[model samples]
Target: MKKRFLGYPNWWGEMPMAVYTFIEKHDWEGRTIVPFCTHEGSGLSGTERRIQSACTGAKVLKGLAVRGSAAQHEQESVRKSVSSWLEKLHL
Candidate 1:
């Protein structure tokens, strides 16, 4: 598997406004927002909270915490979890 690391600019720290703007701009109300994260050790690491606070109108679901190193081997588990979430949300 090929791994790609996405590096954002320093302004990424100011991303909450961008996130809010995107949600409003896209008119994504009544949609479930699943915020998943890959971390070296921290797991979900408050990303879900951030999304919840930023996207006030959307339903922020519990996030999946995947270790970065294990992502390559966790495809099946990830697929199953995502499928289950989709079924539960009926989306």
Candidate 2:
């Protein structure tokens, strides 16, 4: 994957309004969406399902949830996990 990173600086139980708005306005039918998020504790907070529902016909792949703590202090570990996740996704 040439451009594969999606980072969320904060997680207050949902995606930023801009992201949802983008999803609402875009044509996602039959497209594939991969969700990745950084969280302190809540993990992905069901974003995969939310994206799938909002996108109608889109295929939502299994998401990656990297803890903000790990990303800040255990970056190498987070990198390995992210790499493994993308490999599994065939990206």
Candidate 1 segments exceeding 4 Å error: 1-28, 73-91
lDDT of 2 by residue, 29-78 (tens): 66777788888888888777787888877787888988888989999999
What would the per-residue lDDT of candidate 1 be over residues 61-86, giving only the tens digit for each residue? 76566555566788888778767865
Q: Count the backbone clashes (under 3 Å) in each candidate.
A: 0, 0
Model 1: worst 10 consecutive residues (lDDT sum) = 1-10
The 10-residue segment with the lowest total lDDT in model 2: 1-10
TM-score per candidate, chains pooled: 0.55, 0.83
Q: What is the Cα-based TM-score of model 1?
A: 0.55
Write out the backbone clash pairs for model 1.
none
Best by TM-score: 2
Off by over 4 Å in 2: 1-10
